[model samples]
Target: DVAFLLLTFFILTTEFKQPDVEDIVTPSSISKSKLTEGDNTMTISVTKDGRYYFSPTNNPSQRVELLEKMGEKYNITFTEQEKTAFQNTQFVGVPVAQLKAFLQLPEDQRKKYKGSIPMDSANTQLVEWVQNNAKINREAKLAVKGDGGASYDKFKVLFEGLRDIEFYKFVLVTTEE
Candidate 1:
């Protein structure tokens, strides 16, 4: 009885960490170095279908603050409820212009939305998002999680977007081969 109780207590107390971002098959590299997770790290994911998602950190308040700053920069206003929804969001893939509508959608509908922030020469929402987040957290490190099947052009666009903001240093998240 005592051993069973101890086992149950330990099992109940154990914390199981789950991946907050969407699952994407990352490219493999020979390097065995692992990426460390921290509050100062920002992860940007590119899905195989070319959708982009951004997450500054796992902290809700920091994410909200980033969203607020972005809103202020673009002259887009977010309500308290919208701010709360954004705070609870894991990775936002929509452009700032559509963020209000995206947040207003039902959770299931939002998940089904396959839109990504435009990265074209005329549309530089992704670049603006990265720049805004960097301004909010000066010490934050940028990491890119590109899908293994993602096209080179997509990555080129991403690199160009970063270069536009003079952000040359960033880590490419890959798994050991």
Candidate 2:
């Protein structure tokens, strides 16, 4: 009777949503430290292809979304023609300058952006823009979850970018099973 009652209670309280499956990540055998827990944690995932993912944790149990999801949400897709011209030889990700211009634009305005913003301008503008955005988004944790095959150097760049902007709480994401 008690088990049945508990089952009914759980069924009543449980919520369901589409789950976002993350890539399998094998943790390195380096340091064994106690895990920290708090409301202000950021999640970052790195794809095998060297793509970085910054998953916000504002809503618990919800599918993770990028802070830059705004760019996609607003239909700010970079075309192959543009990306070819925009990318450096590495092709790891968007150039820092381009990232800044994209970050600076208001959500609605981002979709309409056509031309690239110069490197120097993007540097100055992105610093301020990230500072303000991070302040506003402090509650949303910034994370980096990289693929097992991604280069350590690329992860270093991503980490430096977040730290340069004064974002501290980074949580490495991994698949549950």
Evaluate all candidate structures by whole-model CA lDDT and list the values in order: 0.82, 0.43
Model 2, span 101-155: residue lDDT tens: 4444454454333332111323432223334335545555544556667778766
Those runs of model 2 whose alpha carbons end farther than 4 Å from true positions after fitting are 15-18, 28-40, 59-133, 173-177
Off by over 4 Å in 1: 1-22
For candidate 1, list the clashing residue pairs, or say none. Answer: none
Instruction: Give the C-alpha miss distance for residue 40 in model 1, angstroms.
Output: 1.9
Candidate topping lDDT: 1
How high a TM-score does candidate 1 get? 0.86
- Tens digits of lDDT, candidate 1, 29-120: 99877788677788788988887887776667777888888898789999998988887666678888889999998776766667788787
What is residue 87's positional error in candidate 2, in angstroms? 30
Backbone clashes (count) for model 1: 0
